[model samples]
Target: MRVFVCLFLVSVLGCSLAEGKVVSKCDLKKEFNNLPESEWPEGHTMTDNFLAKLICHVEKASEFNTSAVNQLIPKKKEEEEAEQWTLYGLFQLSDHLICSDGATPSPDRICNVTCSALVDDHIEDDISCVLNIARKVIDGGFAVERKREFWRMVKLIFQPDCNNETAGNYFAECKD
Candidate 1:
């Protein structure tokens, strides 16, 4: 009887702990609001009411995909843009880019094409352009190191594992 009672108590405690880890809409809204305006794409405005609904969409996403969504809660201003872009890519993939409409291209193909266009905007080589964009995204990392890191992050968001409802909502709300 004592063993059964102990097991019951342990299960209850574990359940409570798990519940505590579940982020509420209010918590997500606060986190979203904390991000700097400059980190968002131009003309995008994040409001508390909007965020509440956005969090609901995010909740429907897989935990692995939403892990990148959690990273958007900025702890520092310097790296916020990189985090923003990562989040942006996820939303772009989930909502608009990764379509099964038969005519739409694959997500990686689209990302590569977009990145290539961005690279073409610069007079420098591809590596240099990537590094420069990485600097602009986050502000202060070594050029070579950030270049590799940036591409890795870009690829990660393009992976099939990262699509979620939060991303879809973001694209719907923010994209023209």
Candidate 2:
């Protein structure tokens, strides 16, 4: 009888613990779009509303920032290591470049403008190496005609290795 009672208590405690956890996707668009311009990297730029919303989606779906993966992998690794994650890098970059509340000076033309709005600042800092890879990616011929391209590159980086488990998981969860 005591064993059964203990099991019941354990089950009840587990249930309560599970119930305490919560995952929400709230005000997603506003989350990314409302990011301030000061957070943008030295050469990259983005509008508050768009960045807030994009970040919301990524935060919900991305598993890149966990320290489970090694940081030595190349930005274009073709395999997923148990010690490395992709969205973490991009998110770190995004956070350092545009999420933090600081003004990072750059050349006047750091970010190109369209329709009188900024696009990407392309800054590089120790906190986020994603910006450096992003600049290299942009230099590879993908023109930044719209903010959508940033999303695409992030997607690519997250899924650099099609056959790897992490990349596969990213594809399955994110679907590009």
Candidate 3:
């Protein structure tokens, strides 16, 4: 009986550990709501739409898993392997462009952050990096003058699904 109890306890603890840092919708919603103006999307876009788009990106990127990591897929086969660069965290920010993996060492490191920082449960850095990227894109007149170019970039992040028409209150659904 003692051995059986120990085994059961070990299995349960192991399962919990394996589950990793997946945040609930409401929890993520709270984080989004608490963000400053600079860390959020701007212009005439509704706040709800911003939240919805965030959920869409998270869903498409890492399925809301904070610790998720994905390989970068290049167009050409000889462009090196998929292991060279990686995407991390909920937004799937690339190590190549935004963060440094430490090993590969992104020279620009546009975010000036470690990739692991984005992959963890703490999302403050991830949000900041995302905003920086958004600002760079929007600054280039993509979000205003060239609507198609803006959409092309946004759609690039959430490709296949952006091509479809789907609507939902991604954050509101978390409300009581």
Of the candidates shown, which would achieve the greatest TM-score relative to the real structure?
3
Ranking by lDDT: 3, 1, 2
Off by over 4 Å in 2: 1-44, 62-127, 141-176
Worst 10 residues of 1 by lDDT: 89-98
TM-score of each: 0.28, 0.26, 0.66
In candidate 2, what are the lDDT values of residues 52-124, reduced to their tens digit?
3444444443332222111222354358543222222223333212223133332222223211111122212
> What is the Å distance of residue 167 in model 1 from its true position?
19
Off by over 4 Å in 1: 1-22, 62-176
For candidate 3, the per-residue lDDT at 176 reads 38
Report per-prediction Cα RMSD to one decimal: 17.8, 15.3, 7.8
Clashing pairs in 1: 91-167
Count of backbone clashes, every candidate in sequence: 1, 28, 0
Using lDDT as the measure, the top candidate is 3
lDDT of 3 by residue, 12-93 (tens): 7666445448877567667767776656556623265566666676877787798788775544357655444477888887
User: Which ten-residue region of model 2 has the weakest summed lDDT?
Assistant: 114-123
